[model samples]
Target: MMISHGFKSSKKDFSFGPWKVTTAKNHIMKSKDIERLTEDLNLRALPEMLFGDNILRIQHNDGFGIEFNAIDALKRINNSDDTLQVACAQQWQESRVVSEHTQEVVRPYDWTFTTDYRGTLIGEEMQMKVTETTERINLEKLRAREQIVFFDEVLLFEDELHDHGVSMISVKIRVMPTSFFTLLRFFLRVDGVLIRINDTRLYHESVPTSLFTDPNEIAQHLAFKLRLCEKLELPEQKQGAVNEDLK
Candidate 1:
């Protein structure tokens, strides 16, 4: 999908299966912020592994980490196009139970989904498609289900401290083919605290009393947890120093 530089000011709400999700404020990451992260974390884009106009990647000292990229439908079939994709390495003591050393840590199984989204038939189909496409890229099958759901775009906010932990927050919008309604999914993860929140709310429709916790609130909580972790900040760079140097 084409990368959109504009920000949507209005808060949005929508549903995916049984869960309701609401859009929080757009988390904007300025070019300076990207530069700071790149310098502080020694990040590099894995262009050969994933394709996108914008990509930021970093790994933690314990081997768990994440990659954020501009969402693209063409790459979604392989589950490589999410705004933020996190991988918890098998060697990480906290993630050892779920890690599959034989397979790439970035695969679908590591993703934590909301109960409503995970239990639905559509959710199952989505997972199957990801697994199948990951194993064998089939453009045809991916496009066939274009009507069901298509990842459109996302905004990301992250805090990664090498020896401490990593916190990632994503606000992603998905399009549903059958209706004009767009689904807003808020995802948050804090490796140090072992906290994972994947909540969905609604948008473009009348607000309903949701039975689940508000996604925005969950995001705030995660942000708070992130703040409690040791901060990782690099000294201010000189005027023209190269920012692309990776350790």
Candidate 2:
């Protein structure tokens, strides 16, 4: 169910024109979930806080929509042995040799958790022919103080990277009187090694005076389907992720 106005509930929801939006906020996954996910993902390790169940879902009346979730996001990380690693690659591997983590190092993977995922598309029509575009989201309109009607943020995953720095991904969304916006960000700081970021933005507006003017009609929608990656020289910095935490 989508709640466009009034008080926010345990879960966040809202609507825009023909679209219905919902989001879930959850704490780290339990050991059982972690074990299953690790085996399925074919990874040596996972983030300390992996909210594999949380997601940001937006759907249209016509069945076209998109979803952002941790499971799918993490799946995008390169598990191949040839994945490009960071500067402190050697240090990380050497450090692991001394720790119990060495047992899981069957192969090399992108420990950074870097992903090219934007969001998962739903419905047949929701997916149009893929094409390149230079269009960008309207930052000016998003900055408008239009009295946010709904807003929430949900974390996908986070890892302290052996206390080296931090790596995580979270999604935030807000709805205004005239439109709604969403941002999915992945941040990484490997300390003294590198700082990286990946972002995905989605925006849609209501235009009552548009060509097909309807009070509840959507005017324009700009989809950010590209993953932005930035790696910087970090001047710095888990285990089975101890069995604990449930929400």
Candidate 3:
């Protein structure tokens, strides 16, 4: 079965709108060793996969967006034995509200821009870039109001992955814009089954807006799928995945 993992943040039920946005720092561990992790995760070089090679482009609905290109920067890291550090950025529309006007005008009140870092032998880092752009009569005014906010950790990915016959991933995530809660997620892919786990902790939050999936439950489901796949004995195929949805 095919599965796509997307960004998830935990927040209070009452927290709403742009101000309620939360960032997360996750420890992403894949099922590859340090020497092979980059290749296995398709992050060996910068601009490797996901959303194509261009860093700046228009989205499906005519939304403008941009991301960092790390190809040249990563080449240096690959050539050197020393530790590497680099920053990547992305800006996109998080959500939008439709206007009552007859024309197709969308008033976007929430946008998310982030700067992220990935290293060969170190944990990942991320910073959310916030811009206060008002949707007024003059569109030019709204376009020029982009700015940077205080730097903070939003997402973290571990450089290494543990083995379990299949690729296993461990991730820790926290709410962004406003820190509300955190989540520890585990993922395992074997044959055609995908297993997911979410361990959550609430902080000053009344109700959880995210769903929690138990690791044990995932384990059982994974076990069943493995058996089923084995029984079916389908031929193995190799394929590549890109982050097209993000663009």
Leading candidate by lDDT: 2
lDDT, candidate 1, 1-247, per-residue tens:
1223455444444544434334334435455654454345333221111112333222223333233343321122223323334444323324222245544333332233212231111221222122222233233433454454434334443333223343333334444432223323334343644655555332222123452278863442232333354778999967875668678
Ten-residue stretch with the least lDDT total in model 3: 85-94
* Ranking according to lDDT, highest score first: 2, 1, 3
- Those runs of model 2 whose alpha carbons end farther than 4 Å from true positions after fitting are 1-9, 81-108, 124-130, 209-247
> Which candidate model has the greater TM-score, 1 or 2?
2
Per-candidate TM-score against the hidden true structure? 0.24, 0.71, 0.18
- The Cα error of candidate 2 at residue 127, in Å, is 4.3
Of 1 and 3, which scores higher on TM-score?
1
**Compared with the true structure, what per-residue lDDT tens digits does model 3 show for residues 94-212?**
11213344444322111111112221221124333344554223334223433322222322221111111122222232333223332223222322333333332222222223322
lDDT of each: 0.34, 0.73, 0.26
The lDDT, on a scale of 0 to 1, for candidate 3 is 0.26
Write out the backbone clash pairs for model 2: 164-237, 191-236, 191-237, 192-234, 192-235, 192-236, 193-234, 194-234
What are the per-residue Cα lDDT tens digits for candidate 2 across 156-244? 88777666677788888887766778889999887886778989888877643453545334424434578799999956532355677
